[model samples]
Target: MPLSEFGDAWPGGVPVQAHGMDADPFFAGEGDLGFARQVVESAERGELFLYPGDQHYFADPTLPSYDPDAATLLLSRTPAFLGVVS
Candidate 1:
């Protein structure tokens, strides 16, 4: 659903998390970063990570586009972002 439809129903102070690859063909990474920036501006809590020259499914080890270094960094950051104790 489009963010415009949320209106005031959107939860306030919710953390937004976004990860994107600069070379992703399925989606524009710059656009993703822009949206993340908007969310961070409004919510004041979020993280946006972009891997340069990576494609879609870069984090999936089974995929040919897998980027081990990027995926490892993503894995480490995800837990901290979510406040997970692991």
Candidate 2:
């Protein structure tokens, strides 16, 4: 759905949570953070990003895809984000 289509029924006071990474596919509504930052700046907003190491998952530490550093960073960073959106 178009973000702007929420109309008057939309919860305008609700905060948004954006989950992004350095390496990932761009959804139809997404673009580079540089582009995101430009849009945020134009709209007087802020942007958050996660560009940690090649860690793909956090729980299964033994997995070949697990990344220790990225997991740690995600641990430290995601809370503040949830706080912001909640």
Candidate 3:
């Protein structure tokens, strides 16, 4: 559902979103990214990570689009963002 639809029903807590710059059109396009940005901007706490030159499934090891660098960075940042590690 669109973020606007959530209205006051939006979930609480910090949101962490990671997306590739070249995300698949079927999954997400420029409009989706713009909407994501709006979500983060409207939220009290949120994080948006955009990996340039990467595509959808960039963090999936089994996928050909897997990007070791971006995936590694994502893995590391995720735990940190969740306060799971220092």
Candidate 4:
């Protein structure tokens, strides 16, 4: 499929807590994303990565702990997970 993992393994009822987390700064469409982006960037020929980011999921762009840069740093190590020759 075009998108890996297909957003599975993410339990339900998480948005409730996330709902009150002030969506003002939680634009899910912006930024490189947290570990999810990192794992995606590390995709190899055959590998799967699934994770949930709702309860304590970091990378809230609006909050004081927005970590957009984490994606870039994680991208650097994706090759290893992908089994690339590097």
Query: In candidate 4, which residue ranges exceed 4 Å CA deviation?
Result: 1-66
For model 2, residues 1-86, the per-residue Cα lDDT tens digits are 33344342324344433334556445212454445444333342344555544333433588886666666766676677567653
- What C-alpha lDDT values do all the predictions have? 0.70, 0.48, 0.69, 0.37
Give the per-residue lDDT digits (tens) of candidate 4, residues 1-86. Answer: 22245554233432111111122234233432343343434443323232233322334556754445543444545766555886
Per-candidate clashes, comma-separated: 0, 0, 0, 1
Off by over 4 Å in 2: 1-10, 25-46, 52-62, 84-86
Q: Give me the candidate number with maximum TM-score.
A: 1
Candidate 2 has its poorest 10 consecutive residues by lDDT at 1-10
Better of 3 and 4 by TM-score: 3
Ranking of models by TM-score: 1, 3, 2, 4
What TM-score would each prediction reach against the true structure?
A: 0.75, 0.42, 0.74, 0.23
Give the clashing pairs for model 1.
none
Winner by lDDT: 1
Over 4 Å off, model 3:
8-12, 22-30
lDDT score, candidate 4, position 83:
55
**On a 0 to 100 scale, what is the lDDT of residue 30 in model 2?**
47
Model 2 vs truth, CA RMSD: 5.9
lDDT of 3 by residue, 1-86 (tens): 46777675236675656455555663366467766776777766766777766377788899898889988988888776677856
